[model samples]
Structures are given as structure tokens and as C-alpha cells.
Target: MAETPAADVHPPYLYPDYKSTRLRAPAQPLVRVAPSPLDTAGPTFPKHFVKDSEADLTTWGKSAPLGEKMVLVGRVLDEDGRPVRRSLVEVWQANASGKYPHPVDDHEAPLDPNFLGKGQVLTDDKGRYRIVTVKPGAYPWQNHAFGWRPAHIHFSLFGNAYAQRLITQMFFPGDPLLAIDPIFQSVPEAGRRLLIADLDLEHGVEGVALGYRFDMVLRGPRATPMGV
Candidate 1:
């Protein structure tokens, strides 16, 4: 496994201390076994985990959610810059009001009955995927004094199977709260910009919604930082 720098982690004092003291040194690398016939064929995965690639989160319920509609489009690529087709990409986020559709989220913001804030899609032959969803709102957190989380979406990419996975978060470009958000700040300064998606007018449909492009490189020097 790749080792993330210790400085890139959230400060121990900001979060719970119980797990902080239990941290240990990195484990030794294990000896590799030669690939068998099954390993040589690579991972065989099921298709259409969430039905199709035209997933629209805002229209999940009886009506569309009240918020700014946005279109997210991106491609998944390997370290060598080749497209990774047939991969599964999943995402979830808080509603436009900064409230989650879960019991544990006790934020005072009102929930959107129409918005479930979850979507999934399978990449095409060209490794491209698209989603239509509302922009999530920033919310407060207890990680620091006057702490506030930036509007973002959680992404889980499955390259081949359960063992080959990369989890991360996507933030909007030019978010002022990112500087103070401990989770976003946990990433090293050099690679932190990779997490922010760029505005893409070319892929965006005029008048309907704005668009953001967030291409991901699974591994390499340009690889996006994965969640630990």
C-alpha cells in the first residue's frame, strides 16, 4: 500500500483521541505470489450496479430538489494515461441545505424531501461518466473553532473488484471554506488542488445547468490523493 505523509493527516487533537494513540509504524511488505491463470485474466465484475449512466439525483423523489443544478462529467484513467473502461463510480453528498439523509446528521438545516443525494454510474468504453445533481451546501463541523465543511461530494471508484478501490472527495473550485476545513486541509498543499473540479463550459449545456470536469488518474505522480 502507498504511504501518505503524516503531515497530510488531520490533526489528532481536532478529532477523537482514542484511535490516535493506537497508531503504529508501517507494516512490512509481504512477499508476492506468482500470478495464476485466474489472476492473469484480471478481475471479472458484474455490469450495471446502479442500472445505467444517466443517473439524476435531483429527481429521485416526487419532484426535483430546490437548489442549483449542476452536471459533473469526468473520465477515469490509469497511470499510463489509458482510459479505464467499465469501472464503477459511486457518489453521495449532503442535500443543498447542508443536511444529510441520515439519522446521525443532526444539523439544523431543513432536509429536501425530493433529494436523496446519492448516485452511481458505470464508465463507458472511453472511461467517461456523467451525473446530474444539485450542488451540496457547506455545513458546520466540530473539528475546529467555527469550523465549516466545504460543499463537496464523496466518490468511491471501483477499478476492477473489491480489492482494487480508490475512495476520495471532490470539492468545488474557489471554495473559501476549504482553507479552514480540516478534512480538505489534511491533504498536502502540493496535491490539494487536484481535488477541486474545474468548470467546463464545453461539456456544459447552456441555460440548463453548469458543468464541472474532474478527471481522475488512478496511480502515478499525477494521481489524485485517495482517502486514507
Candidate 2:
């Protein structure tokens, strides 16, 4: 994709490890957009940021079983490993019964009028975005004979309109189905972790406090030579 110029556009927040990292915004958006933005992600194209916001998606019904509660926490960074503050991140997931809120979810769960089963995160300078939500139930897909999809979440990360965007999902570890799923295996092994993050294992993270850590990576400008 053609590179956009950084102008009035806003960036997202950057983050680091357990240790603290800088939380600063750029003078403007680093990329110049076209008519708008690249939009979504698939196997064919690479996105500026790789994400899986679905981990936090849990509707009232037609999906997974409802529990005490849950939370989704993650970070957003650029190719250079910096936060892209002011960027928008969206995620959606099924309810405890494995059904979605929309009519498309023909599963068994009921619709959660209170719970949208979705959320948005605007990054800070440190690239961190967090949400409090419930764990979603496993749903059905056309992947196998029985066609049961592994427990997963869907994510949509946005950069400056014209720049590269991403749409991807995340799956929990130890899921037996990933071994046979073609799409999960499509991502390069090195980049796979970019989508699937580790679970936060604090004392009170489950029951009413399940903690999920998801990170995203967005494409940034080409490295400018020092002389320039």
C-alpha cells in the first residue's frame, strides 16, 4: 500500500513489558491516508496491527455460558515496537451459550441485551488497551466434520485511515482443534504470538476477574536513514 504522510492524524499509545515504558504521542499521525483507511485483515494482506479482541466478546446468549465476569487487557504497538495512541480497536465475542447477539448467530445462546458482547480500546502512549468483560463460549464453524470452532476471539485494529489495517482472531492455548485448523496455521510461526497473547495469572483473575492479555502490532513508516 502507498504510504500516507503524518499530519493531523492521531496516533495510539505505546507500551512496554512489566517494567514501565514511555507514554508519548507523536506530533501528528505518521501516515498520510487515501480516501480513508485500508479497513480489514485477512490471510492475503498484512495489517499495521495484529489483534484478537474477540477474547473479551461474551454476549447474553447464543454463545458461551455466563460466569461471574471477565476482563480483556492488551497492548498496541507499531512495527518499530512503539504504541500507536489514539488508534481505535474493536472486539466481538459470543455469549456463554456460543451464540452471537446478531441473527447470524444461529447457535443456542440467548441475546444479551445488557451486554453488547463487544468493546473498543483507544491506546495510550505506552500502547496499552484494557477492557473488563466475560469469557466467551466456544462456537461452531465449518472447520471439521463436527465443525466445532476452538474457543477464540475476533479483533479489528485501525491505524490512520489510508495506512494498513488488520482484522484477525485469537485462540486459547491447549485447544486440540488448532492442530487441524488451516487458518490458524497460515500465520508465520514467528508472528503467531502477535495475535495470541498470554493469560494474566494474578490471584483474583478468574471467576469475576479473568485477565486476558492481548497485544497488537501495526505497520509504521519505512526506516529513514540517519543522514536524512
Candidate 3:
């Protein structure tokens, strides 16, 4: 009996326009614990812990890494839409001028000595999953005076252990900074179009790259809005 999240779908741990969720949300009132046995069975994930060039974040350093080159397929359903096969996704972004090779990200753009954005994959038997990065720019956060942060891409999804993880962020479809992105408006405009991401010209790749399609849905009423 665990499937009742279709009101706002999800998002509101205390979203006061996402000012760090007002100091990291959760101000008392959430204490349920009862899952052990290693959280329902061990942490399986072998088959060489992902490596096939690590799902291609544009060849991971040493060349090819500038901007505007996409291709992010999807799929990992389960809410009866089936298909949640291998699992384990993971991603990360911000590079193409929005910076973030991390050190705390000073911003001020410019940082792509081959773009070490991030990547990882695994999910076949039909649950799909593809990547190949580039296209991330849009950053400037203080969360108030001209705050910006749209072009996202930060999913995480893992299952069959580690307490069945899940995280989200995928935006990028017309992105006018997603109308003043307060963490994507704290996601509730009807699940905010399920975190946008749908261009898919057959999943592009004729002149090099251009697909989008971001499907996730791990829960009820079409869930897919958990960017934390």
C-alpha cells in the first residue's frame, strides 16, 4: 500500500521559493522506520559497475567537449508501465559555459577543458537509457536577486538496493529559465510537465546529435518531479 502521490505529484518539503528549502526543509513531522534486511535485500550491481566509456559524457575528457550536442534517451517506468530492468542511471551537468567542474563552482562561466560533467548507465532489457552530453548552460543562483538555473540534467535512479534510490532533474524544452525556476517552481504545476525534455527527432543523430526524450515515472499519477 504505497502509491498516493498524485496531488501535486511531489515537491514541497518546504518550498518557500526554494531558498535552500528555507535551510534544508524537514522541520519535524516525519519519522517512519521499518525496513531492514538490508533495506529489503542487498545492494546488487555487478557486471562491471558500468563502463562502456561510462555512457558517453562526450567521450570524457581529451577532446570533443564544447556545447550543443545532445542525445538523452529514457525509460525506467514502473507504476504498471512495466520496464524497470537493470536500473542504475546517474548523471550530472553544467558545462558549456555555465561552469561547474566543481570546487564549489565559482561560476563566472568558462571551464571546459574537455568537460568532465559526469555520467553512468545501465538499463537494457528494454528499460532503455542513453546519454552523451553537452548542452547545460544556465546558472546563477543566490536564489533571489536574478536567480537562474534551468538547463538541468541530474537524475540518479538506482534500485535493487541502496534503499532503492531515486532523484531527478532533466529540464530543457523551451526553457525560458522555466519561468523563473524556483527549483522548477517547486514542481506542482501539475508535476511541471514531468520535468520537461522531449525533442526526439527519432532520437536524432544524423548530423551528430540532437535527441531528448526523458521518461521516468517511478510512481503513481505519472510521477517524475523530485529534483532534490
Best candidate, TM-score-wise? 1
lDDT of 2 by residue, 49-147 (tens): 434443344443465445446666777776666666656777777755566778666776575655666776666567687766666677766434566
* lDDT of every predicted structure (CA atoms): 0.74, 0.57, 0.77
Backbone Cα, N, C clashes tallied per candidate: 0, 46, 0
> How many pairs of residues collide in model 1?
0
Residue-wise lDDT of candidate 3 within 1-228, one digit each (tens)?
122234366776777887777777767755445655555443567878988788888886788999989888988876667777787888888887888888988878888888888988988877888888878898898879988888798898875444457798888888788998888887778888988988997786879888888988664212322221
Candidates 1 and 3 compared: the better one by lDDT is 3
Candidate 1 has an lDDT of 0.74
What TM value does model 1 have? 0.79
Error of model 2, residue 100, in angstroms: 0.6
**Model 3 stretches with alpha carbons more than 4 Å out:** 1-12, 15-28, 36-38, 42-51, 60-63, 67-89, 98-118, 121-143, 150-228
lDDT of 3: 0.77
Clashes of 2: 46
Worst 10 residues of 3 by lDDT: 219-228
